[model samples]
Target: MGATGTMNDAWLTLREVRAGDRVAVLSPSWAAPAHYPQVHEQAMDRLRERLGLEPVEFPTTRRTTTPRERAADVNAAFADPSIRAILSTIGGDDQITMTPYLDARPVRADPKPFLGFSDNTNLLSWLAYHRVPAVHGGSTQISIGPGPAPHPLHLDSLRLALSGGDHVLEVPTQISEVGHRWDHPRALTDRPESYPAEPWSWAGPSRAVTGRLWGGCLEILSWVLAVGRFVRPVEEYQGGVLLLETSEELPSPHEVYRMLRLLGERGLLAAFDALVWGRPIVDDERMVPDPVVASRARAAYREQVLRAVAEYHEDMVVVQDVDCGHTLPQHLLPFGEQITVDGVNQRVTAHFRRAPRP
Candidate 1:
C-alpha cells in the first residue's frame, strides 16, 4: 500500500446479517415512492430468510416529510446500543439537507458499518471526513427489492462488504439492460423489466497500485465539492483508488467534462493512481431517447469525459463501464479504505485495512 491516511479516523465492522441482531434501517432523506415499502420488505425478507439477518426499522424509516426527523432517527439509531449497524432504505436526491443536523458523537463512539449509495453520498462523505469507513452501495429498495432474483454481482459485492474479507470485488459482466420502475403497483412484487446482461470489461490499467479508497455517485460527489466539507488534501490521494459513477439523472457528457474539469482546475484530478468510473444509468431520462442517440451519448462519455480527465491526469489509469451507480446489481465500495487497482489485469479490487468477522 502507498501512503495511508491517519488511523485516528477508524472503521467498526459489524457482524454480517444474523438472524437475531437488530440492524437499523432508516430513510436518509426522501421517502421512496409508495410501492417501495413492499420492495423494502422483500429486501428485508431476502436477508432474513436467506442470510438470516434481522431487519430492524426505525420510527422515521418510512416518513416522507421531515429532514430533521430523519436525522433524528439516524441519531437515535446510532445512539441505541441495540443497533449493531445502519442501512439505508434507499437513496434520496436531497439527503444532504437532512444530514446537516446529525450528531457525530455516537457514530464516532461506535463506528459501525453504514451502507447506501446515490444521495446517501452525503452521509458517507461525512463519515469519510470523520475517518469512518462507509460502504457505498446496498440500498434496500433497489438491490434487494423486486428484481427477478438477487443479482449475483450485487450479492457477491454486498456479501464481501458485509462479511468483511481478503477478497477482490469483481464486477458482473452480463447485466440487465432495462431499468426497474418505481411507480407500477405490481413492481412491488419485484417484477422489474429485464435486459441482456452487459458484463464489465476493463479499458486502460497502467499498473498495479493500492491505497485508501474514496468516492461515491458522481452527482452527489459534485454536491460535496460544492458544499465544501473537510475534503482530504490532494496529496493524501496519490496512488490511491478513486471511485466514481453517475446517477439516474444521467448527466450529459458536457456536464461530466465540466465536473472533471473543475476537479482538475482545483488540482484534484491529478491525485489518484487509478480511477473506476461506473456506467451511467440510461433507463430513466435516457430510456425514451433513441438508442442511436444513447450510443452516441455513451461514446461521448468514453471519448469526451474519460479522455478529458485522462488529459489532465496524464499518468492516471482509468477504468470505465464498471457495474455501479444506479445500474443493476450494484456493488458497495468502502470509502476511506484500501483497494487494489490492477491495470495489467483490468480489475479494481477493494480490501479492508481492518475487516469485520462474518
Candidate 2:
C-alpha cells in the first residue's frame, strides 16, 4: 500500500516477524511479570512453544521501573538489530508518563513492529506520531496468558499482522466477557464462559467507507486528549477509521456518552470516515453477577454509543458489537493500515501492507 493521503510523515517500514527471532518484551505501563511470576512464565512458555519465538526481557519487563527507564527499554528494542519485534507484558493506568522520556530519532531510524493495547495506546500514538505503523492489540499477560490457548481469532490476526498479509477480519462465533482472576489458583486452569456472539450492527450510510485504522481504548484516548500529547491536528485524521473500546473498568453508559460528546465537542468525532466500536466486556463479577443485569448493561452501552453517533455524524458509517476490545478472543488491529467497513454488507476488512521483509 502507498502512503495515506490524509497525513504526511516519513513512513517507516515494519518487517514481518520471523520464527526463532528474538522478540524484546517490555512493560511501559504495568509490570505484570514482576508481581505474577508464575503467570508470566506460563505466558512466555506459550509464546515459545506455540509461536516458535524467543522472548528476551528488558529492564522494565519483570518489575516496575521509572518512566524514563521504561522508555529506554523501548528505545533499545527498536534500535537493536537482533530484536525482530517488540511486545508489551500488559497495560496499566499511566503509560503517557513515559512519552516524554522516549527519543523519537532512533525509533524513526529503525522502526520495528510494536504490538500492544490499552494504556499501551500512548506508545502506539507515539509510534504513529513518528509515521510508524504498529499492531494495536495483544499483550502477554491478558491476551495470551489466561486459558489453555490464545483465542483462535486472536492467534490468526496476530499471525497475519506480524507475518505480513492482508486479513479480512471476521466476528468470532463465540465471545468471553469475563476473565479468570490472576491471583486465583484456578485462573490458569479455568476459562471464561463463552456467550452467543452478536453480529455487527451498522449505523448510518449503506455505502462502504475505507481508511487507515486509528484510535484505541477510549479511556486511554481521553488521557491522551487531556495532555494534548502525541496526537496530531484533527485534519490529519480525515480518512481514518476510529477503533474504540472501553476497558474492563466498564464505564457506565452515561460516561460513554460524555466521552464521545467530548470527542464531538473537540471536532474530532466528525473527521473519521467510519467508526468501529468493540463489544464492551461486562467482566466485573461482583458488580453485576446476574446474567440478566449484565445483559441490560451491555444493551445500555450500545444505546449510548448509537446516541453519540447520531449526535456527532449521522452520515458516518459505524459498526458496533465488534470483537476487538477488552473481551476475550481479541483481534489485532493495525494502527495505521487500511480497513474497509462495509455498511451495506455488514462486514469489516483489514488490508495489511504486503511489504517485503527488510
TM-score of each model, paired residue for residue: 0.88, 0.94
Looking at model 2, report the run of 10 residues with the lowest lDDT sum.
1-10
Q: Candidate 2 — which residues are off by over 4 angstroms?
A: 1-5, 8-10, 286-291
Candidate 1 residue lDDT tens string, 200-293: 5455546887777777888888888888764766666566677888887778888888888887887777777777887766657432445555
Candidate 1 regions exceeding 4 Å error are 1-19, 33-35, 171-173, 183-191, 197-205, 285-295, 353-358
Candidate topping lDDT: 2
Error of 1 at 267 (Å): 1.6
Error of 1 at 331 (Å): 1.5
lDDT of each: 0.71, 0.82
Per-residue alpha-carbon lDDT of candidate 2 for residues 76-104, written as tens digits (9 for 90 to 100): 99889899888898899989989998888
Total backbone collisions, model 2: 0
What is the lDDT, from 0 to 100, of the residue 131 in candidate 1?
Answer: 68
